[model samples]
Target: MNKFGVSAQTLIAAAFGAAIMGSAFAVPKLLAPEAGAQPIAIQAPPGAPLSFADLIEKVEPAVVSVNVVSTQDLSELGDMDQFFEQFRGMPGLEDFFEQRREQQEQETPRTREARSLGSGFFISQDGLVVTNNHVVERATQIQIVMSDGREIDAELVGADPLTDLAVVRVKEPGPYPYVKFGSSKDIRKGDWVVALGNPFGLGGSASAGILSADGRELGAGSPYTDFLQIDAPINRGNSGGPTFDLKGNVIGVNSQILSPTGGSVGIGFAIPAELAKEVTDTLIQNGRVSRGWLGVQIGDLTPEFAEALGIEDVKGALIADVTTGSPAERAGLKRNDIILSVNGQKVTDSTSTTRLVAKLIANTKNKFDILRDGKPQSISVTVGERPADPNAISPVPGGANPAEPGAPSAVPGKMLPDFGVRLSPMDDATRIALGLRTGDTGLAITEVTKGGVFGEAGFEPGIIILDVNSRPVASVDAFERAIAEAKAANRSKVLLGLRVGQVTSYRTIDIPK
Candidate 1:
């Protein structure tokens, strides 16, 4: 087979727009199937047509192309030096810097209006619309262009960034045609699904493919993602659109695709209907979502871990720890207890458990089934409302130092290699450059072992270790003491507060073997 194709891997940006420029090549139309190649023939239970003409005709009316105009800084005269720094010894260094110097003659900050494209559909007869949060997030002005060429202004109902779901309302009062969600649980593997979206700003485009695997976790950016994998031809502008079942019910909302050349290679992902419905319903009601929290850290019960715990079957989520004063602690849920179900629903794994608990109302009592010491037990937990931003520390008026009352002592000058990380004391100049204020004492990561646990867990040089297990560690001795305590207690993971520049976050590292 003579194959000619480009490598494609593109994760759609959080904010999509036409301002992101690229060259487009017109694809040549094929006369027929080439040299022994055949067209794909698919059907629904052996009775549907190969083409989805009738289905598309019915659903296309509700589809729309969402355009958003936002104003932001495009470039700045001060950035010229940094931009030219990359081409330090390139062939056109002189020409590039000369042109940039000419442009710097004006010496002005560059700001411009940017346009982005994505697809969406009407979900209610009263003008309620559904789309991706990334599509309309931070949008200054939003315009919805219908399939029949009617442009309508829309207002943001609300958006949940954690779930990547959003809702908007149109100003024009009407009984607009909308799509309904079908049971995603009923959709099976290999079932025919249709995707409708404005791919690359082409309004009301549709592609068909079989359902791939479901319940995929994209890991970092999407910690709570349980995506429905599809083989549809979803592109950049397809975000916030709908994927439909044979009976014309929306099964999923297209959000991401797995590609290398910015084009679909038949591996696309969608937010499952159940999750989307849950998020949208909350957004419509409260104009916000409050996820229920149990305040317990958990991990999957793998077979090896289960056997180590002397359990017979590899099931349930292993409770790692319970937060103080949290709902889980108040409900008497102890560490090492395996959560088997939520409200009688089976907890397949830790991720599903998190998703299930998030759907429950705050301050509501939910039944949790657990395994404790080889016996099954049930407990009723009154879940608490999860905080909107966990990383956000409420600022005190006239910034008070939360550090200890005593004047800071000098830091030790020794380095460590026990945790696969070498620490160095941050000097006054380094501390000032890293944006650390008074009373801030963070140990700089002078070195990271690439093959060790620190690097494997994404730790790199230039990150400052601020604390260990919520204990502020200003010296190497403090850090070593924390690690020694955890190791003595036979703990596998030790949590650390890390400061990368001005932002601080938590990361867990596995104890080196």
Candidate 2:
């Protein structure tokens, strides 16, 4: 049973039945005025579209059907019911299914062929097409069917999985019909828009609806989300099809639909052309999209938190922690600093700040206005290239940690009863072997108790703790002092900067209750 108390199998059966018996679309007929002396034509509000035939005719030629053939391993397949779930044990089919299942079970490491259908559009005259990355991802063979009924083999030029956009090309000499991407900024809610795609394998289907909303994030992974929402009836086969404005310009790419019935429920999502253009342009030039990274952890400022920070307006991204040796730290950005603007544009939230920062070119200097200690401060920071995997932490090169200048006490190591770790001062010989500079301050973690918080937090031996809550700690006394200060200040967690071999990073740990 489905969550709505209907049989899930019943819905699937209904959909398959519709597919077999569905009829083609027909244009609506205009009703004649009933015996009136004066005749009036269809009227719409000013600047609204009353008709779509002209717009559809001008751009329909640019649309194409994307079909892919892929292979699936038999090991991935399960029992017989999986194959017959769609058939649902109908009359006179049980024995046939049983025989087929028995024959299939005799084979070892078998394979099967799968075919998928999707929609795409021509972005350039020389057979350059744009579609969703998922349509052609892992596809062994792809065929593009033009509106003229010509099927052409296409090659993948580039694909960006982060934005779900891809580019393909066919090396043909003749020019092809194409569509131009228009600015999504100009489109607004209640504006008339049209979606053209191969819905349900029906070629060149068109649906009309208004822009229901914009900047909708439907949790389609990746932080580059800024989906345009529309009431157009897009379906499974409509992925990567273009949604056009009244002037026949492509403003969005229909990507997803929100429906429990496996059909359009008047809620469909499209990748905004503005964001799509950026990703496709990068894919065209670099074959992949590269974004700038700030290496800072930021959070949205709640009203209560803002009031405590003495800010009248509860806006902007609050910096919770900055990575050690990162561009933000090198630029003097500190924890508790509020990011107000980037490149003179106001940042409404943490996500906006990330989007703005990512648009910046790596190694380019950008201006940022921040609120530090209740005062406005301006600073210039050079952006850095984002790592391939932002969540991974690499071990620092051995002997690269910096050591303190002072001499160690008689004993080098001491046990922390509360934190459940053995901390030790960095001796010169050990520091030299570890490649530490003379100015680095921190005690080395000799051991972390097996069941301790640090162990569960992924901390291992050989890493040096350089600072606690932004305060340098070269000895046990200093470490204890910093922890005391953090607790006294009523902070729930303390940020720690650690030197793992040559790499430097920051970690936040909760204060023990």
Candidate 3:
């Protein structure tokens, strides 16, 4: 078993399940259906619908198969001499290898048309369709196959890679059947959800399952979206299809699946309708989305951190570092401030805080409630437009060059036995190398004993200890004084503000009692 207590699996984008073509075979006469044969009937479980045929029929027409054809450059395929080398001495295989090489040499085409399949559904009568961005993002040509086998050429309208959603319009206009978005927030765990898609290129396939979970963050790839988890057996070629409630309203869009094999193992995720609808509308109106930027690196307030801060509840985001000249910096936001809320909405964690700030309109004043030095305060900041490249706003800090003439080198300092680390006073050279402000003061970690408390807690050499229990520590003496004060206060742990490389963060260390 893996760390998650389940078998290791891969998260696959459900977009391209290749359809296998097979030779036809004759059927036995004995296997043929008898005249006036009746369909098999199965007893329904309690509280279950007798059949989903009616619901499937109602929504099947709007669902479509997205066919994408893009050019693939094959010039990168290197020589095949090594591949043919293995068969040189094999019995009766020399001729086969030579023939293959000759055929490969004769083929001079450098590019080929690659076809991929996915699913989508019309969202308007004028042929506006919703699908995953990956489905048609690279398509040189797109075709939508309807339920009745009618093929209509389509063009990409707009796509949002952050949310993995896209809008496409059919070139041939018509009064098409479409589906409407429903409130995904109202859907509860265990509520029945029917997924309609073209799984494995099988057009108009439907699978029934419950909403396994909601508000799930897959990873860093989809920071803006909190995916709705389902067990609807959606598979490849199902990307961008709609998951419908019993009312035939689209509540989610099928996007990905977690499976040991490429096929679905029942764990699937979809984009919630609320976020999807919002992004779709914006894409339809604008070619791209522009999010608000707060310009602060934040971390979750853990229970240990709360104890250090003398707080009863650990329910806020800890501001680690504020960008220079950012909206946050201009609003007087500082390091170590705990964000309690944004615009009156209570901040739950770092992720929620990021999402909240991103939803704010650019150039608009927003209220932020924060806790500084155990006191509550509110500040108003005019949000700015997020940079096109997220990293452009907060690039990774460069490493220090101790070899430079004026760079500070590690010096022997007082050792904190309990923490198994030595501290040295920060100097002008160290501050400049760290790219810190002139007034910034801290005790740099000179050495960390392996397998000791500090090392186990992730403390390492070159890290600077900025504060102890919110008190600035400018030297080894100050760090010792703060530790003594914490011990005198009978605190079990003390929070330390640390500057690791260029990023600021907080870590709680146990106070030896």
Candidate 4:
């Protein structure tokens, strides 16, 4: 009986083991699709794949890690901080903040070695790399590292601060992988994109995202400044990297982000490939970019102004001032004229108009459509080279006459009133009272009339007026000179450059002539 029981148990054990083995073999066969059959014909909905593995495989080799090393002298850091802080207000606290920040940066070392790591990509097989100008701006040494762990020294070929792009060159030439430029204009919102960069200095890092927005203006930070905003995970070291389309084309160059915590908030900005490509080409060809310029100071058309001019809406850039002898003035672009379009393309804002005009080849004759007194007018003007000095105010030659000695005291008629501030010449006492440095020069306000033009214009008694109608006014004489020129020209508004506290700023006001 015992022998019979043992035999039965052994047979049952053998049967159970065979069943388990058979189940394992059956499961794999069932899960694996048959070679002759398809994936059940499951339809992938119309959109990009949820995974970026294919993108990484296609674009990773084109991306490179950029390492920059710069030196910051202790005194220079203190001075730069002080200079910028003065413009941000709290002039008295400038030195205090600088000292504290310098100490902190020195002790804990925000960047003692002055090392910055960013990402860039090859534009040509001969080892030409394109990146953000800020990435390698002050770097004394630059190292480019490839994906296969090859490091090589790179030389800065050229950089354009206005467009925020830099070009660098590596010594070795090869059948190097690179990306072709794509038209950013064709990219709409919600387009799939893959960002390749060295995020946190981790080489060959990639993240996929979509174009969240386009034509984002960051507010006068750069001259040629239409940016494509993306929701990619671009971090500190991601600047200068390439944002690639699904076809592995370089669509944009990742530039900036709106982050307060110094980390990726998934809102990254890219210089559109359209803009970057032009700059890169110029840099590669001439070692610098030459941008065309139409010399005019423009203002956003306000509702009141638009209605006054019989414009249906604020749709065009209003000409506030035209530089004397400049292309605009030469082409008869008068003050108060609304710039409706540039080269026949409607301009809705200053940024778009500026960008359009910039893209014009230098010395090319372009047509500017304008609206004056409710009538459309066309003016032809030749675009000229942008002035090298942004700070040098264009002079209004013979625009004002010298006030006759012993003449009746002329008071401006229709003295629009508000805060009762008056314009006067800057003196030692006034400068000391206003806490102005010796280098400061402008028409200082000594007193205020109750609700007068000075008040209406948002002027304070201690404020110094530097420029009127885009013309520099270093003294009371120059201020009066500018006012006379505006009256003679029948202009109703003037833009003033001001030096308040310790920093230079600008404001626009309407002056009834």
Best by TM-score: 3
Worst 10 residues of 2 by lDDT: 393-402
lDDT of 4 by residue, 1-513 (tens): 232233656666666766788865432212444667654545655677878898789778889999999876444566666666655656667667667666766673343458888989998888999999999988899999999989989999999988889999987767688888998877779988889898888878888889999988887777686789999899988999999887778889999989999999989999999889989998998988887888877767755545333346559787755665678877888655778898889998667788788788878999999887567889999988887763364333443221221211132322223324545556554444443434445576656675566666666655667666545566556766776776676666556666565344556666643
Estimated TM-score for each candidate: 0.63, 0.62, 0.79, 0.65
* Per-residue lDDT of candidate 3, residues 35-82 (tens digit): 877545567654467678999999999999999998887752255777
What is the per-residue lDDT of model 1 for residues 201-278, given as tens digits with 9 covering 90 to 100?
Answer: 888799998898888898856767788999978999999999999888999999998998999999999999988897
Candidate 4 yields a Cα-based lDDT of 0.74
C-alpha-based local distance difference test score of model 2: 0.79
lDDT of each: 0.78, 0.79, 0.85, 0.74
Candidate 1, position 80, lDDT = 73
> RMSD, each candidate, Å?
12.7, 13.7, 13.0, 13.2
Clashing pairs in model 4, backbone N/Cα/C closer than 3 A: 417-451, 417-452, 418-451, 418-452, 419-455, 420-448, 420-449, 421-448
- Which stretches of candidate 3 lie above 4 Å from their native place? 1-47, 70-114, 394-408, 426-435
> What is the C-alpha local distance difference test score of candidate 1?
0.78
Clashing pairs in 2: 396-502, 397-502, 399-434, 399-435, 401-436, 402-437
> Which of candidates 1 and 2 reaches a greater TM-score?
1
Per-residue lDDT of 165 in model 1? 89
- Runs of candidate 2 with Cα error greater than 4 angstroms are 1-51, 70-114, 219-222, 323-325, 329-334, 394-513
